[model samples]
Target: MVAEHSPLRVGIAGHIHLAPGSERPIADALRVELDRISDRPVHGVTCLAAGTDQIFARVVLATGGTYEVILPALDYRDTIVEPSRADFDELLARATRVIHTGYRHSDTAAYLAANRELLSRADRLVAVWDGIPGCHAASTDRTVDEARQRGIPTTVLWPAEARRADRRP
Candidate 1:
């Protein structure tokens, strides 16, 4: 259990398909939100997936905050595309702690389990969601809903200029 004076442990859930040029704005918004909690140190919790999760981890570290990683499955690294593999590996190495969900595959069940674990350990959740219902399982909206149900304080960040990129092949 965390002590009362421990750094605020903030969990992250966000979209992987970020628009071509939305990263900067979305990251700025995230920085703004995180800065609001400046009274205490920040400890981020993330799956380090490809888009917003990576961005959140970067912001946390860049701002002198630390973060932990939660892997959805043992083969989660294999699921990352070549382009994103470097970021994933880099962030994973810098994590203050790393946890695995004990699943062999990166599937919906594993993702849900990881999300559950993330929420269980976080004092708050930051969702970089667009407020749209997710079209598939293991989405930002689903995690946001779970966080809400668990009554974890949640913050949604969708900048006015932020958009989702087309899904990759």
Candidate 2:
């Protein structure tokens, strides 16, 4: 847990697809929302996967905030896909803490368990995702729901249409 004087600690969740159009806007929105909630400054934690996770981490770092990484498995380098491996490595280097969830590379159960562990520690959750049912990103959805159930606040950033009116044409 972070010190009380430290900024709010936020956990970021989202799908792993890199659909370029939505990524930048979502990252910007998350940073803005986080800035609004913290008197000190906001810190972000992520698994540093491709797509939403990488984008969130990058934005947090860019905004002079701290980032922590909770890896899904002991050897995350071997588990993540190739293109994303470099980003993950970079995040690991920058993280304040890198906790390995003690799972093997091939276990889906371990990954979900790791996700739960990450969610358990956060003061709030910021999710960037499409509101799609039965998606592979269901873990993110589940994490947000579980956080809400535990009375932690959740902010979701996605389904761009709802926020389209605010965008510059």
> Best lDDT goes to which candidate?
1
The TM-scores of all predictions, comma-separated, are 0.94, 0.84
CA lDDT of 29 in candidate 1?
94
| Model 1 Cα lDDT, one tens digit per residue, 11-63 | 99999888888899988998999988656559999999998999999999988
List the candidate 1 regions with Cα displacement exceeding 4 Å: 1-4
After superposition, the stretches of candidate 2 with alpha carbons farther than 4 Å from their true spots are 1-4, 136-138, 159-169
lDDT for 167 in candidate 1 is 74
Please give the RMSD to the true structure for each candidate, in Å: 1.6, 5.2
Q: What would you estimate as the lDDT of candidate 2?
A: 0.75
- For model 2, the run of ten residues with the poorest summed lDDT: 159-168
Among residues 3 or more apart in sequence or in different chains, the pairs in candidate 1 whose N, CA or C atoms overlap within 3 Å are: none
Q: How close is candidate 2 to the true structure, as a TM-score?
A: 0.84
After aligning candidate 2 to the native by TM-score, how far in Å is the CA of 89 from where it should be? 1.0
lDDT scores for all predictions? 0.91, 0.75
Residue-level error in angstroms, candidate 2, position 135: 3.9
